[model samples]
Target chain A: MKHSASVLALAMGLGWSGMAVAQEMKAEVIHWWTSGGESAAVKVFADQFQKAGGTWVDTAIAGGANARTAAINRTVGGTPPAMMQFNTGKQFDELVENGLLNDVEAVAAEQKWKDKIPPAILAATVRNGKMYAVPVNIHGQNWLFYNTDVLAKVGAQEPKSFDDLFPILDKVKAAGLIPLAFSGQKTWERNLFNAVMLGQGGAKLWLSVYGDKDPAAVKSAEFKNVAETYAKLRNYVDAGAPGRNWNDATALVIQGKAGFQIMGDWAKGEFIAAGKTAGKEYGCVVLSKAGGGYAMGGDVFAFPKTKDANTLKAQAVLEKVLLDPTTQIEFNNKKGSIPVRLDVDTSSMDVCAQKGAKMVADKNQQAPAQELLTPPAVTGAVEDVISSFWNTPGQSVETFQDKFAAALKSI
Target chain B: MLALRPRLASKLSAWLALSPATTILVVVYVGCTAWTVWISMTASRMLPSSTFVGLRQYDALFANERWQISVSNLVVFGVLFMIASLVLGFLLAVAIDQRVRAENVLRSVFLYPFSMSFIVTGLVWQWLLNPTYGIQAVGRGFGFETFRFDWIVRQETVIYCLVIAGVWHAAGLVMAIMLAGLRGIDEDIWKAARVDGLPPWRVYVSIVIPMMGASFATAAVLLATSVVRLYDLSVAMTNGGPGIASEVPAKFVMDHLFERQNIGLATAAATSMLITVAAVVAPWIYIQSRRRRAA
Candidate 1:
C-alpha cells in the first residue's frame, strides 16, 4: 500500500488516546490527546457516553496528524471508528467534499447548536450549509503567560501591548532568566511571529498579508519593523530551544526559570498541573490594545460513515454526549479551554480560562485561529521560513520579509 | 497428442503455477511505480490533479534546504550503518559458533529491537538520547561533569544518533542469519585450517567471510529495505529540526502526502526513490541470475 503523508505520521510515533472509553457502545476513537491532562480531560466524555448505554474504544494516538491518518485509513479500510477528532478548521474540508463524513445535522438541530456556538466556531464545524462535526470545546489560541515571580524579580508588570512587552522582555533578560521560553518548533515560531504582528502590526497588517495577500503592505516599513521585533525574540529564548516541546517550554516559566511564554491558553494547564496558582504564582494577559482578542480554535469530533448498525448508534450517542452542556464544561475545564456554549457558567474555571471565556463571550474580541485563514500546507511551509530565521544567527530581517511575502503569495 | 519430455513440461507447469504471485507483484509494485512517476510530473496539491508545471517540484526539491540536507544525511547514515552492522554481526555470529556461553541471552538482547516495532523503539531511543532527561543527566548526577553526549541536539551529528539506534535494532538479526550460514559450513574447513596452523582471524576473514555470500546478500537486502523505509526514527527523535538539518527523503514525502497535502511532490519523491532502488537492484539481480545460470 502507498504510505501516508502526515506530520503526526505514526512516523511521529507518539499518540494512540483511549484511557476511558474501551467499554460502552464500543466506539473506538483515535485522538492525539495522550498527554496526562488531555487524557484525564477526555475521560469526562468517555464516562458520560458509557452511562448512556454505549461502549467506548480508546485508540489513544498522541499527535493530531497521526490520529487523523489512522481514522482516515480505517474509514477507507471498511472498519471506521465511531468518532475521530480534528481541530475545528478547514483541515477536514476535503473529507466533507469527498462525502466521507456523515453530517450530524440531526443532533445539531435538536440542540440548537447554531445559537450556542460562537459564529466563527460554528462556521469551522459546518461546511456547505451542513454540520459535519460537533464542536466540544473552545481553545483560546493566543494568550500571554508570565512568571509572576520572574516578573516581580525584573520589576515588569503585565504587558498590555507589544510596545510594553518589548521593554519588559529586556528587563526580564537582565534578571538572568530566559525572557521567553520558546520551544522553537516551526509552527510555534510562526505563531509567535503572527502574535507580534497582530499585537504590534495590528489587525489591518495581519489581514492584509494573510487575508488580502497585499504585497504592498508586506513591503512596508511597518512590516520590516514587525520582522525586527520578532527577530528580537530570538535572543530571549535559551540555546536548548531548537527541538524543545511546547509543554517543557511552559515548564521553564512555571519553575521561574523564564519570564514569559506567548503561547496558547494550554500553558495554564501545565502551570496548574505543577501546583502553581494562576494570577498568583503565574499571571495571564493578551497583547493588542487596539482591542483584546483570543485567536479562537477548538476540538471537534466527526463521524466517519460506517455500515454497522451498532456503530451507527454509537456514533449518534457520542455526538449527544460530546455536545451536552454539562459534559462540555467538565471536559473543557480539565482541557484548559472553555465550553463551546456561550451560555455555560465560568465561575468554576481557572482564572486564565475565565479570561478566555470572557473574550469569546464578548463579540468584539473574537479572532479565528490561523488555521481558519490559511490551509495546513501554506502554514507549514511558511513556518519553515520562520523557524529558520529564529534559529539561524545571521538571517537578515529584510531577507525574511521578502521570503515571508513570497511564501504567502505562492501558497 | 505430440509426445514431449515430461520433465520439461513439468518445469513449465511449475512456472505457470507461480504466475499469480508474480502477476500481483508486477501490477501492485510496477503499476504503483508508474503512477508515482506520472504524479511527479504534475503540480498536484491535496489530490492528484493534472496541472503540469514540468520539473517545478523537482527544482523545488533540489533547491529545498531540507531535501539537500536529507540526501547527505541518508548517504552518511546508510554507509556507516550498513558497514558497521555487517562487520559487528559477522563477528558476533563467529563468536557464537565457538560454543559461546549465554548465546540466547546476547542474541535476544541484540535481536529484540528488530522484533519490537520501530515506532516504540524510536521513541525509547529519543528518550535515552535526550541530554537533560536521559543518560547524560544521569551521568552528571553520579559526578561526571565532563560527560558530553548530546548528538540529538547538534545539527552536525544527529543523524549518527539515528545510525546508533538503527544498528542496535539490526545487528542482532544479521548475526542470527550469519550464524546459520556459518553453522552450515563444513567442519572439514576448520579442521584443515587447524592442521595448517592458519590463525583463527585469518581463517575467518579469508575463507569463512568470503564463503558466507548468500547470508551477506540476505542481510544486505534486509538492511537496504530498512534504509529506504527510514522514517520513524527521524520523526520521533528530531523531527528534522534545528532548521531542516536532519531531514530525510521518506519524511519529506510523508510531509507532502499528508501534512503539507502536496500529493504530487510526495509521489515525485516516491517515484525518484523507486527509480534509484531499481537502478541499483536491477543490475545486481540480473548479474546474480546470470551467475546462477552458469553455476
Candidate 2:
C-alpha cells in the first residue's frame, strides 16, 4: 500500500509538470541587473509578462561580464535560458554571427519597433539587416550629477558647460569639500574621460575618435584640449578615490560631501533610492562646451535560439512586454534611463530622464556611446590608455593623444 | 601459477581504477592546452575561429603596453613574494623551535593565514594599507601627523603592497613546513653540536638548513605554484589599478578572454604563460629525474 501511494504521488508530479509544459509559457531570463533599483526595474517586466499569461523565471547575476559569460556559455552548450541580457552593443555580435541567437524580426516588425525605437539602438539590435536583440532603454553615459546643497553651500550656480565647471570645482575645493566625487577604477576612469571628451571636444570628435577610429582625430588640437581638461579635473579628486566603487562615489555626492560626480544616468537610481528628488536635493545636467551631445548606452535582452515551441512562444511574449509603451515608461523610471521608444509619453519619468528623452529625440544630440561605436576589445584598449593618463598626472597631453591613437588602432 | 594469477588480477584492477584519472589528465589538461595553442594562432575574437594568423596575436600581445606591464609586475611580485615568504617563514619556524611557551598556539597562529583564502587576505590587507582609514590614519590619530604609508595607491609601489600581502599570507605555511623539518632533525644532532661547542646559529646555518633541503624544496614548490596562478589577491586588493601598474599575467588573460572578447589574444597570453612555466620547470624536472636515477 505504501509503494502504491509513492507511485501515485510520482505520477501526479509528472502530470503537473507535463501540464505546465503544455499550457504555460515559461521564460528563464538571465540578466546582470541585480542592484536594488535594477531588480525593481526588471520586476516591471516580470509583472507585465505574468499579466500577459506567461511565467517569468529570473536568473539575476551580479556582474555584467560574469552574467554574459555564463549566458554565452549556456547558449553555446545547448541548454540556454529562454532569454539573456546584454548591454545594447556588440557584446552579442559573435552570437549573432554564429547564428546562435534567434532574430526577433517577426516580433519587431509586428510591433513596428523600427519606427518606435531610436535609430541608433535599432541599428545595434539589427545586425546583418535582421533584429537579433530587443533594446529596452537608453542610458545617457555622461551626466554631471551634483548635490544642490553642496553647490549652494559654495555659492555656485549649476554649470552648463565644462568651462563653467572648473571654477565651481575650485570653489568647492576652497570650501574644503571634495571637488569631484570620483571612482578611481578603470571603467569609471574611462567613463570620466569620455564625459570630458563629449563635453569639451563635442560629438563630432567623440564620433571621429570612436566611430571612425581616426588617428588624425586623436592628433587634433580638440582631442588634446579634452585630454588636458580630463587631467586638470584629476586634481580635484581625493586621495581615497583610488580603488573606490562608483556607488560609493555617488554616495559622497548624495551626502553633500562632494560637489560633483560625472557619471551615467543610472546614478539617478541611487538618488531615487535615497528618496531625494531631482532638481531639489540633487541636479543633473549634460555639459557641452562645444554644443555637445547626450552619450547614449543601455541594455537589451537577446533571445537565444531554441527549437522548443513553448520557449519560442515565451520569447515572443517577453519581447512585446519589454517594448509596451506603458511598461517601457515604468521600467525606465526605476532603471534611471529613458525608454528606447522615443514616442512614449515620458512625463511620468523624473526631470533628469525627461531631459535625457528630450536630448535623445533630437537628431544632433543623439551621440552613440563608445561601446556602440567600437567593440569591447578596442574600447578596453583605449580605456587602458585613459586610465594610465588619469592615474599618472605628470603624463603630457601629446603623449596621451599619441597613446590614445595607438590604442584606437591596436585591435 | 596460482599465486601469479591473484597478483595479476589485483594489478589489473588497479590499472582499471587509474584509467579514468589518466584519461582526464590527457584529455582535459594536455588536450585543452593544444587547443589553446591552436586558437592563439587564429583571428578569434568573441569565439574561436579557424582563420589562422600565424604569430600575429603574439606580436600584438608583446607590442601591447598593458601586457608588458603585467609581465614585469608578475616577475617583480613572484621574486619578492617567494624570497620574503621563505625568509620570514624560516625565521618563524626557528623562533618557535626554540621550545618557546605556547608552541601549539604559536604553530596554529602561524598557519592561520594560510587557511584564509587569498581574496580574504587581500581585502584585509587592502583595508589595513588604505591611507585614509588604515595605518596612516591610525598613526595620525596618535599625533604622528607626518606619517605616510600609501604605497597601495601609487603605481610604482603598488606591486610591493601585493608582495607584502602575499608574504603575510604565505609565510605561515612556510613556517609550518620548516618547523616540521626542524623537529625531524634528530635530537642527537643538537647534542653533537653542543659537544662540539657550536652555537645554535652556527649549527642551524652549517648543518640543519642543508639537512632541511627537502622541506625547503617542498615549500618552494608550493609557493611557486601559487605565484604562477596569482589572480584573486591582485583582483581583490587593487584590481590592477593606478594605471595598470599592478596588473598580472593571469588577470590579463582573464580580462581579454571574457571582458575584452578577444579569445585569440587571451589564448596567446595563456600560451605565453604556459611556455614560460614550462621553460622554467623543464630543466629542473630533468635534473631532478636524473639525480633520482643516479640515486
Model 2: lDDT equals 0.93
Fnat of the models, one by one? 0.40, 0.76
Scored by TM-score, the top model is: 2
**Candidate 1 lDDT by residue in tens digits, A38-77:** 9999999889988998767788887788787788777766
Model 1 Cα RMSD, Å?
A: 7.2
Q: Which lDDT value does model 1 have at A356? A: 81
Q: Which one wins on lDDT?
A: 2
Instruction: Fill in the DockQ of model 2.
Output: 0.72
TM-score of each: 0.79, 0.96
Candidate 2 local lDDT, residue B260: 93
Error of 2 at A3 (Å): 32
Top candidate by DockQ: 2
TM-score of chain B of 2: 0.96
Model 1 CA lDDT for position A308: 57
What residue runs in model 2 are displaced by over 4 Å at the alpha carbon?
Answer: A1-23, B1-11
